[model samples]
Target: MAAAEVSHKDLETGPPTGSEKHTNGVGSKVKAHRTKDAQHGDKDLLQNVFIGAIDAGTTSSRFLILDGAGTPVAQHQIELDQSYPRPGWHEHDPQQLIDSVRECMEKATADFTSKGHDVSDIRAIGITNQRETTLVWDTETGEPLHPAIAWPDTRTQALVRELKEREGADELRELCGLPLSTYPSAVKLVWLLRNVDAVREAYEAGRLSFGTVDTWLLYHLNGGLEEKSNVTDATNASRTMFMNLHTLEYDDKLLDFFNLDRNKLRLPKIVPSSSPDAFGKVSEGSLRGVRITGCLGDQSAAMVGQKAFTPGSAKNTYGTGCFLLYNVGEEPVISKHGLLATVAYHFGRDKKPVYALEGSIAVAGSGVKFLMNNLGFVEQSHEITDLAATVEDNGGCVFVTAFSGLFAPYWIDDAKGTIFGITQHTTQGHIARATLEATCFQTKAILDAMAKDSGQPLAELAVDGGMSASDLCMQTQADIINIPVVRPAMRETTSLGAAFAAGFAVGIWKEFHELESINQKGRTVFEPDISEKKSAKMFKKWSKAVEMCRGWSDEDEDDASDQE
Candidate 1:
């Protein structure tokens, strides 16, 4: 729980076998020859290759040092101080974002060295961050012009409505692979230009620099204005609604549509997710001079971490919010469904960019957090699983978790969080079960949409993040989706993905096949237990609840307008 605490638990769930031999920076099949005096065995040889990953998430900044086997050697995490000045407005201090990362790196590096490992062995570092969080800074001074507008912030809701009616709005999605919504950085940047005086003035003066969290962190981590390592990967740039999905570059048409001048505003260069030289080195820290080789948006990194490289492979991350991404292969699929299309990851400059169809649920683990902190249903978040298990089923209850409106296929903005079928027979267990089922139902819906868009059914769902730790929840998910839910023993796949990217760029692993055994040990597979008829009945009831919950938020808005 402490920020500087170091976890020493063995992350590998099973004992190493004879086949799990060490590789000396070559592919997995080629074994490293051991010297006669090698005392630590494979682990000592593994110490020769380690990759560092900096995970800048929604609520925390973490640094993880992982071995060649994808096991974390040392790590440190620090919770971020989030500011919600008004409802639907989330902001983070730009300085604190990089500061927390630097501190985490220092602390994690200290832990790594204290364990008798050489810090110089950290061959390359990678960065994975929360995507679409917009930041602007002065090009001359390298100081943030305003607070970082987080991805979840809905401050541009009214602006989104106006933009949707604009002439070129309909064509925007086909070009950028994103709908005109409050989620993208383009709208956020437009809002700042219109409202924030400092940002507007800087933009007008041609001294403004715009970047997502990745670029901001890279700039500071690589020695700020002096080094000027202001660049973002294709995965992050794809979310900005400014980059062309096919070209992987900033589009002039998109800039014109958003009314942004390329001459006036300095945007970060779009680079491959895994490159040996694109991301610069850590300027001054415990791992100073180490090359930062790989970078990805968190979800993309998680996909790589899960090794979901093949087409039709899908991953569902149930964090504060749920994100379901289905790999559609090299070409980007412009979603006919309510899902968003985006780049999955691009390994190198020459490698063709892989794309995915994304479906975002506004509430997942946050719904569980509401149960623990708001409703006092349990003392801890994980206890909600225990409470739900007290009931065999939801007892005819269905919860529509639309706390800040639903996303993905439904796109129901006028619906609030609603629960239905509450009878005298319903108990806390029933509600708890329904709460867990809400995420599962949404995931099933997203997968259905993805199947429609890509013409490929998801064979198994690779899951991670906080909510995936619950066996009851994962089992429910498996039952509802009628597919196997695969969970790796090492759930820190986001960090591992970044490390893998860095490792790949530096030739620690030569090919994708070489990473097959890295984090595959002791994985759990939850099989579908319920009958298809039973699953269909439950899903139908959930659909009815979703329809019933519509217009609740709109009604509240109308009532407020009447009062005014």
Candidate 2:
């Protein structure tokens, strides 16, 4: 990709100073006009200002440098250390998350500058992070009072049940567009406040601050409480079970339901996903002086990167977990089905916030991780697809990847990871194929539920993320769902999404329509190869396996209850 041909800075010289022209279409008050670079005088002043996106994912942290055309120029990633001290508990050191982000940014920026690109040309930083991962930190010292509670942590299942048992608990769905689930940040926060003495003491002393990874990153980036750069985007705030889907702000009643006192517990101010200056600048580091311009939750950022901006547009991201989001336009649609209602993205003020219905599958690429790390089936994750490709099919094997139990449409808490119909004939390839097929089966289930909840059938599915890199898995997904699976040329759509939001905010791309022609090279499409009847038959077997695995945890729990 060449330079942007035209620069926003060059266009500013046109007309009288402070002229108002909507150059970038809707809501842009910036002066908009094409002008030859008078300073360079006949030479092209390469629109070298690149946008950087910090992808703080579940398992790792990544920094991607994207040009005006959404092409990655440089990238660096660091795998995060995850701790599981107890069964079904997940946590990450808050400082570790911040350190990973900093390292990624420094490494990526070093690469960017080594390529003769000016570090000063890095205009802004965008942040997209794992949603619902709760963190509470001290205001003065900028240290986490407790480890960042991972989004998948189910330690609060009992507390969630207590909330559900409370009167008016059912009204939370209507109030916050979320169910009383253990996945939400509020439940995790409640657990921290109740169980962790440090967190409770911090809150009581009015020095506690709550934020997801995005807000945490922003706080540190902007120099912490002294700089007062604690702000979360609408997309990230939507996952907290505190923000109102309609107002796009934190609801008092929802906060009260969680028993959170705002005065004692300082929450980040909810801001638009993309803004000119709210998130503040990187006060220090190699990328110092770069402004933090855009922020979004990971799934919502994936939606933006895939350009699923229209009503009924949908995309599935197969990261550590898989998330399928169906865009429902400006209005939030509360899901009667098992899906979650969330803000897809908000460009800025005056632009309507896009809403979505999302179905989250907790075991996607991580299932492959289990094969690589726990079972030692493969040296690397990519080999699972290669091993599976050796076998024509699953060989009558069915794997229910419920390591953390099923999510979305099938909220089966009692199920564990199960491999059914494993005969002597079952080889490594059979198990490998079954594992990959398990994700596809769950995806098909989510898609079915999405269609039911949204009252709209998907024409095609746009996919990105680590697992979508496998052609076998994608083909299996297409076959199981009987829908075309579309993948972008650059599979780093998650990072690109954050870049897009940042670039748009600073007028690099000018308008949303400008992105339609970008990042389109080498896009692949997988059409359904198997017959619908065959798909149905295979899915029926998977459904049966899912049923067979249910209540494995419950039986033990029931025995314990009886003993009590």
Model 1: how far residue 156 lies from native, Å: 1.6
Regions of candidate 1 where Cα sits further than 4 Å from its true position: 1-47, 554-564
Estimated TM-score per prediction? Answer: 0.90, 0.90
For candidate 2, the 10 contiguous residues with the lowest summed lDDT are: 1-10
State the lDDT of candidate 2 residue by residue for 392-434, as single tens digits.
7788999999877788878876778899998889998889889
Candidate 1 lDDT tens digits, 1-564: 001011112111122223223321111121111112212324556556899999898778899999987889899988788787765677899999999999999999999999999888899999999888899999999989999998877767667777888899999999999888767899989988888889999999999999999999999989998898889999999999999999999999999998989999999999999999999999997788999999999889989999999998988887767888898898889999889999999997567999999998877877887787689988867677667767767888999988766788898766779989999999888898899899999999998899899887888899888787766677679889998887777788889999999988998877887777666656666667778999999899999999999877543342211110
Model 2's alpha-carbon lDDT is 0.80
Cα displacement (angstroms), candidate 2, residue 195, comes to: 0.9
